[model samples]
Target chain A: MNILEVDRVSKQYSGHKALDNVSLSVPEGSVYGLLGPNGAGKTTLIRIINHITAPDSGSVTFDGHALTEADMPHIGYLPEERGLYKKMTVGEQAVFFARLKGLSRSEATVRLREWFDRFGISDWWGRKVEELSKGMAQKVQFIVTVLHRPKLLIFDEPFSGFDPINANLLRDEILRLRDEGSTIIFSTHNMSSVEEICDHITLINRSRNILSGRVDELRSRWADGHYSITFSDADPVTLMEALAPMAGSFSTSADTRGRHTLDLRLLPGATLRDVIARANEASTIHAVNEAVASMNDIFISAVKANGGDTPAPVIS
Target chain B: MSKVSIIIGREYAERVKKKSFIFTTILMPLFMLALMAVPALIVAMGGTETRTVTVVDPDGVVAPQLVDTDNVKFVIATAGTDTVAASADDDATLLFIPQGIVEGDKPLRLVTGKAASMMLENEISSQIERIVEGERMKLYDIDVKSIMAAVESNLSVNTVRTDRDTVGSSTMSYALGFILTFLLYMMLLLYGQMVMTSIIEEKNNRVLEVIVSSVKPTRLMLGKIAGIGLVAVTQIVIWGVLIVGLSAAVMPALLPADVAADITAMNSGAGTLAQSNLDTDLLSALALIADPMYILGIFGILLLFLIGGFLLYAAIYAAIGSAVDNIQDASQLQTVAVLPIILGIVFGMMAATDPVSNISVWTSIIPFTSPMVMMSRIPYGIPTWQIVTSLVVLYATFAACVWVAAKIYRVGIFMYGKKPTFKELIRWARYK
Candidate 1:
């Protein structure tokens, strides 16, 4: 079941359309990836969902009801631009955010202490935000974001400022939060991380959702009809001679250790069997594999194909 | 707590916990005390200054009855410009009553070695006039009755107001009005700017987005301005109570015993000052100042106007803070908020001098300057309709400012980089 739904939302600024008829459905207890390039209206859509800015036309439903101010407590939003009061102590800010999310003071303190202890940042409670490094401040914001135990957590570039170790820790916590029944909507430029964790994907380009589906489905949908063949005793000339009749294109290269590999794209009527049989006529085949598109490749191609004016800001 | 209250708490706590706030709260009262005490101390020491004057009577007219007091002594010198010049070396002021003195020419030449003192000069002149009067009374022999008849019977008024509460010094009223107007004026400027700085700080740090996401923008603005206002109010009230209390305690110790007794007698309403032989201006000023009712009345006015004036202006200050990306960039916009407050102060100063004049009446009834102008006029007992009209106008203006400011603030706080023009801010009010 989808926990949050944005329906036909459109928003316009003074001279620009920030979002145009955009829609998305975030399922319960699953990680959903919101993909977009720079100025493709991702931030604007996220802001609308958070109710920081209302959509000029459209409705947002949470769980089964129209979203309202009272529903804010059930939704945790960590904006792409992270900030905290510089002069405020970490603990006080934590409790204050919790209270703003409708937690009682005692409940906030207890939960905050547990989160701080779990993150090994209990020492930061007394430190002012300006005294902390950017990574440490991001951690505080992360803790504040999830401390309310929200049902729907929208994190925009949550891993921007973390070291690998801390990144892994946060990744683990995000997965754990999902496992414990919170639906997550994650937006990032790190395509690898999205591949690792995101189950569902929606790609937006030029203020429109161009492609969306399961992560695996998107990868397969964008895959080129090519196969990578690893073989023994296969010379480039022999393979070219034997496969040129059925193959549309081919490339061959030898590694420094003298292992030869051949790449081939089949003609429209050709099958894997035809390529494999032709390859066998030339040399002993050790292995044959089809090349599936990576998320990064799919993202670039989809954006290019849709004619995006500028590239998305890629973090990794 | 409501979300607005949480924001209010955060805003208030951040400021009150600052070292500057702590130091200002403690140091400002001490500064006021120093200002009040230093002058009173000087007046208490006034009796000890001494001077000597040499009288040179060329006509043999003024020597016999020129008696001297302990602080101001006199010595008779033989008549001449040369003798006066010789005595001048000792720094004794030389007072020359020439033979042609009755003609009012060569006009009572007094010479001294240093810069002249008006008090010492006036003392010598009055003594010479007395001595000359005695000599003339004997020469004329029938002149005492005629001299008495020649004196003009000037009439002076001792006014008692219809309220039967006679704290009777116009200077004291003007002084109290000036003090109260200045205090409210300062609180509004200081606290309104504080709200502006606080807004700009949050904007600069990029924390305003996080805050606005949690609470509505209007609520956030309200909490911020009202919270900082409460802190200013608390500080001013504490200062007022401290000054009043400290003055009550320390003033007696600072003043001489009989002066203290006279002040207490006036405070206690024991005797009408007009009936006393001591007809000094200082005693009347003291009587007016020491009236607890008058002081209390001023205290009440300050409290009323400080909050009202501060909120009236702080709303616009917050809006100005939000309309720009940086504090320095916010300055041009700040002038819009600052002008009315400065006008109010200057108007109050002008209007206190003539509360019943048309300009005072007009300015005091207008909401922008009324917080200050009305307070200045209040001590002079403003008419009820003027006070009511001013309050209604000001309250309405303040409400309207909050409404307009909130509209600008809601959208402006999230805007980055560009410095918005006044027209753009107005447009933002209508934007989604």
Candidate 2:
């Protein structure tokens, strides 16, 4: 079941449309990626879901009912532009936000301490936020965001300030939260991370949702008719010669271990089994796989197809 | 706890723990006292060094009558002694009296190594004039003591209100009114700005979005106002306790033994000491101050006006704080909150002198100025109905203002990049 459903939502600012007829569903217990370029109405959609700002012409449903103020406690949000009060103690600020999310003071303290311990930041509880490094502050913000055990959590650009190890740690925590029956809305410009963790995604561009679907399904649907095969102890010339008669284009490269990799783009109506049979006659086949596009390629191509500008893909 | 209370608790605790808050709470009263007392203390402590006036009285008539004062001494010099030709290092002033008949002809010249202060010059000239006048009076046979006695008069005016049988001191009323009114003015401006600064701080911290997601922006705004308002009230309450406690402990030691005894006796037997030989004005002023009922009355009124006035202005300040991106941008919108507070003080001063004036009555009734204007009038014995009406209007207006301000705040906090104008603020209030 969809935990959050935004139907035909639209938001207008003073002189511009922030979100235009944007709609997406966040299924329960799933890691949903809200992807978009800068100023692509992603924040506006998240805000509508959180009820930070009302939609000009749509309704948001949480669980099975229309979202209301009472439902706020059930949702947690870590906005892209987020911070803790610098003068406030770390432990105190976490408890304050937890209480704001409807946790009792003692409950907040107990839960916040557990979360702090889990994050290996128990020693920083007494320190002021200003005294913390950017990575430490990001950890505190993340801990507070999920400390209340909210059913639905929204995180915008959660990994921007973290190093690789910490970002991986955060990504693991988000997946863990999802596995524990929480619906998560992860909004970010980092497509690689989205490909790594997101179960489903909605891509927004130019104030409208341009593409959205299950991550694997979208990748499969956007796949070109390309395949790659690895041959063990095979000569590069033989690998290329093996595919030369297959009525298709072929490229060969050899690894340091002397195993040759041949990339093949089959012409229409060419069967994969036939290609494998042909290659088997000349060389031992180790593996065979279809070439699926990455989310990065899908994102750029989709945005460009919708008349949006993206930097030219660099070839290496 | 409720969201607003949680927010209030944080806001209050965060500021109350600040060193600046504690320092201001303790030092504000001392600072005010210093402002009033420093000049008087400087004047009371006059020049400490004594200077000698070298008297060249050729005829020896003026020298006999010249007397030494605490800070000035007369040193007689013989004729033909040019004191003016003394070394430049000499600090003494030369008082050269020409040898002439009783009829005035030549003036008395005073020469100093350096330029003499106007105070010292006037002192010397006045002293000589008095001496010469006494000499001239001898020729007329006028008794100096009787003439001096007839010229000095001790007059004290007591104010009696025809509306009531009470005879109150106008001076006490004015002093109390102005002091309390000025205090309200300061608190209104100081705490109002505090509310704005904290809001801007939260916005800059980028924490508003995180907190507002869980709580309604209206609740958050009210929570902030209530929290900061509680801080203001806490400071004032601390000050009140300190003032009352310190005066109770220290006033007796500072007062003269007899006056303190008279006060104690007056407390024990009111009419008995009233018939005794203590100054009625001092006794009444002290009695009014020591009256628990009166202090409670003023304190209660001051707190009511303070809360109402603070809520009214703080709502406007909060809206302004949210509308702007930074403090520099806030200055322009701050005039909306500042001008009304300034007008409150202006009307308060007018009320201090004439409590029943039309402008005073209206300003006291208006919510924007009522906190200060009504406080200034309360000490002057304003009607009970006027106080009730003013308080009702002040609180009602506060409710309306917070409602409107909450609307603006809800939109303004989410707005970034552009600083909003007043028209935009009003338009934001119209948003659903």
lDDT of 1 by residue, B246-332 (tens): 777777788777776777777776656655444334665555544556666667767766777788899889889888888789888
| Cα-based lDDT for every prediction | 0.81, 0.83
Worst 10 residues of 1 chain A by lDDT: A307-316
CAPRI grade, predicted model 2: medium
Stretches > 4 Å off in candidate 1: A230-267, A279-287, A312-315, B33-45, B49-70, B74-159, B252-271, B277-281
What does candidate 2's lDDT look like per residue over B14-49, in tens digits? Answer: 889999999989987666544533332333444656
| Cα lDDT of model 2 by residue, A34-151, tens digit | 9889889988888888888889998999999999888988998999898889988998888888888888889999988888888888999999999999899999999888988889
Candidate with top TM-score is 1
Model 1: DockQ score:
0.59
Worst 10 residues of 2 chain A by lDDT: A307-316
Chain B, TM-score, each prediction?
A: 0.79, 0.79
